[model samples]
Target chain A: MKTKSTIAIIGSTGNMGSAIAKSLAKGSNRLLLFGREDTKLQTLKNDIHTLNSGADVEAIGCPKDASWEADIVILAVPYAAEAAVAEEIRPYVTQKIVISIANPMNETFDGMVTPADSSAAQELQKLLPDAQVVKAFNTTYAANFAEPVIAGVPADAYVAGDDEKAVQTVTELVQSMGLNPVVAGGLAVSHTLEHMQLLLIQLTVKNNYNWHAGWKILHN
Target chain B: MFSELEKNLRQHITLTTDEFDRVKRYFVPKKLRRKQFMLEASDVCTRMAFVSKGALFSYSTSEKGSINVVQFAFESWWMADLYSFFTEEPSKLYIEALEDSELLLLKADRLQPLLADVPAMETYLRILYQNAYVALQRRLEETIGLTAEQRYLRFMERDGRLLLRVPQHMIASYLGVTPETLSRIRKQVS
Candidate 1:
């Protein structure tokens, strides 16, 4: 029943970030878009407004400023850059939802970069004890974000977070993007979720699945 | 769009051009895509919006998620859940755009400052509220007293222009009748 949450998407000019922004525009939430280039973010903002003119969106150049004003913060940077961005906005994100959407793939894209025991999301959670770090969108490719339906079923957006309310908030958010949200249990489940992405990426690259593959759970 | 607002303003109170110039800053401009929700039942109505373009409708829902259509607003009309706005409670109604809409939004917190800054705005708001009250009473009377056929006839007479903009299903909801019943009534009238 929640409506109109303020969400900040850092690195919003990236593939995952822009795709999420465009689809999320259809919802009533307010979006604070931040990226390396202000002009690019503004262009992305305009595109979203084109899709839904009633969307409340602003392009912010400062990451800290955008994160400071938002209720939920989605870190869409690569795994390599996540630590720096997390620390930069650490102080401002206390009690706020910080979603990690990076799949820590190795340079060759054949394997993951994170330790076997941890994930990008878990590392983010460790960095910001005050913020609710949830892992989502890591399991799906950027292409699937625009059109969530693949194989005639809505792709499952697997979300993992320790905070139930934050998890629920993200579930609502994923639903807003016209996807199905599967609560994949506590943040520890993020390691598996990240691995799932790694496997999918490898499969797509190796077998030429065209990067349109995503997860879906079917039940009677 | 500003002309619609200006014409609406010119009817009630006199405002110097400079005064009207200052009035525009208090309101933020927003656009809603067709079928976009302006306010959902779970949201405490934080903004009262004036429709500058397009059309919108508001409705309340039962626990089972069936809607009871309440009102529709077109260009130059204002829409808000007054009870939610005043009491700061979660709204019981959902306000949605029937078409791509441009709205000038007045935030709840800005109301006092706006009235204080522009004394003429108070006169305009008073007239707006009075007319809104009169309209509400008339709507209630029609809802309770009129037969379904009479209501359909009255709607065709008064809001026939909306037929092109609003869907027949929503219009049926607004008339407090089933879609089949409305379809039968439409056939009877034709």
Candidate 2:
């Protein structure tokens, strides 16, 4: 039998990272939580241990010297920190699927603050060309990540990358999180998905709607 | 013309020549006169067009009938009202050729068959949609969060090629600013 995929969450102390760790814990996969803050990382480790007794959970403070040899690595840090983090983690990641959830939204609430040609994911991909960079998990809120369904709204997640095998790998991970995975096209198509998230965020703020609303591709 | 199409396809779709032929069979080659509408408001966008040559713009009319340009597709670009194309609902936008154009048009009906016949094309299309979606998200974020000057700088830095290909007015429309305002902003930045 194939060994269950090993998964690591970088910036695991954050809400989104912790939530992803929790979601992956159900699949009998080994989970590694890496973060800059030792106290927060330890709390998350304890929390995951409490909830998922069978899942292997380990937490470590940064300057990640050891190699991260996982089937998948979820970069859950803020957009501002992504470039540096990608640089630091590049040497450690080889032949693994690197998933970037960072959205480069400017702090002033101006939508995305990144260069038009260079998305946070694209930049991360450039930083680690050896790893199959798949952009996923940026659209949905952290709260939605942990919930089976948000207010009965089925959140559809999009997976996009140049690699077919990497996209398939991510599709499975999305399914494991109890969300529908829509193959939204290739790596460049990630621009549209990121824009869709911005539209959703705008609608949420403008209409006083909950961040729980997520998109699904409906086929007749 | 075919080379332009090939280049665009290279960016979006990754398939073997045989696989591309399988998917290409589904598309119908067509020509559009300047200012002709490929798709119009209230029409269901059943097709996506690849610009083999010339240019096209996908836009919407505001309630007052003012045009809001959403996307501009130059040679080798892909143009479609994705929301309308997928949902089969009346499109709120219009897709029209800005210049006399040659195109390879693919309809929704052809998608599944192509996917079935050329499995690699599915990967191509999946990647295409993913890239488009990612761009849309970034644009939306820019519209909401960034200042006008910042947005202009970001747009220029990101799509310098587009700045050269597209007209100033259209760029202003996409940026949600007035053409004169865009000019002034450009002057200030320069």
Give per-model CA RMSD: 13.1, 25.1
lDDT string, candidate 2, B37-147, tens digits = 778788788788888888899898888877899888877778998998898888888888788877777767667876888776777787779978998999899999999
CAPRI level of candidate 2? incorrect
lDDT of 1 at A190: 89
Candidate 1 — which pairs collide? A53-B31, A54-B31, A54-B32
Candidate 1 per-residue lDDT over residues A14-128, each given as its tens digit: 9999999888888888888998876788789889989998998988768887876576899998889988998898766756789999888899887788888999999999988
Each prediction's Cα lDDT score?
A: 0.85, 0.77
Q: Interface RMSD of the predictions, in order shown?
A: 9.4, 21.9
Superposition error at A103 for model 1 (Å): 0.8
- CA deviation > 4 Å runs, candidate 2: A63-67, B1-190
User: Model 2, A140-160: lDDT tens per residue?
Assistant: 777787764766768788888
Per-model tally of clashing residue pairs: 3, 34
